[model samples]
Target: MREPSMPVRENAAEQLEERQSDRAYSKPVVVLDLLWDLAFVAAATAVLLSSRDEDPSMPLRLWIVGYALQCLLHMVCVCVEYRRRHNQVQGEVMEDGSGSGSGSGRSSSSSS
Candidate 1:
């Protein structure tokens, strides 16, 4: 006779198998995202440099502040994107059903 928890176990196993089969991210997608981030960084740097020679008036100060903010925003965006891509790659690897044993199984079992 099956235990009451058996169906729950089977359902959980099926859900895990489904998650494992999902394809979350691709290498080309990550590469393109990185390239796009690089472009934003380059553009931010250009704006900062171009404003360097401006007169020290209020408008110039504002422009400098704006450029600095842009640079900071771009850096934050790059960091977020990189983290997102890394997470996606990890998810994809887990889902591939390759049984690569990348430590997730151990972690999940430990949590349970």
Candidate 2:
């Protein structure tokens, strides 16, 4: 004999609710991303301004160093943001799972 069917509609509703809750925190993440981009832009501007001066051979070396440093900083920022976003997503999934499990447990205990 087949087992009783699970409440698919209720499960879908719960998932939708969890996704809505997760989206509430998206604004801060977006703001952080924008801030990083702004910082990179500022670094590029500084490099350009400093290199524009006529300082014989030193300015060229300085410009090269500045460009390399800027590239490194930008890469680091991207990696950090990527890791932070990944962690946030994992945390949300864990929280959602725990919430659903506890809710189901409560419902089951109440009916017994």
Q: Write down the worst ten-residue block by lDDT for model 2.
A: 102-111
List candidate 1 stretches off by more than 4 Å.
1-58, 97-112
lDDT of each: 0.61, 0.60
Whole-model lDDT, model 1: 0.61
Write one digit per residue (lDDT tens) for candidate 2, span 84-103. 75575666557668555545
Instruction: Please state the error at residue 41 of candidate 2 in Å.
Output: 17
**What tens-digit string does per-residue lDDT give for candidate 1 at 87-112?**
75567577756858645554454356
Score residue 111 of candidate 1 by CA lDDT.
52
The residue ranges of model 2 lying beyond 4 angstroms of the native Cα positions read 1-58, 98-112
User: What is the TM-score of each predicted model, taking all chains together?
Assistant: 0.38, 0.38
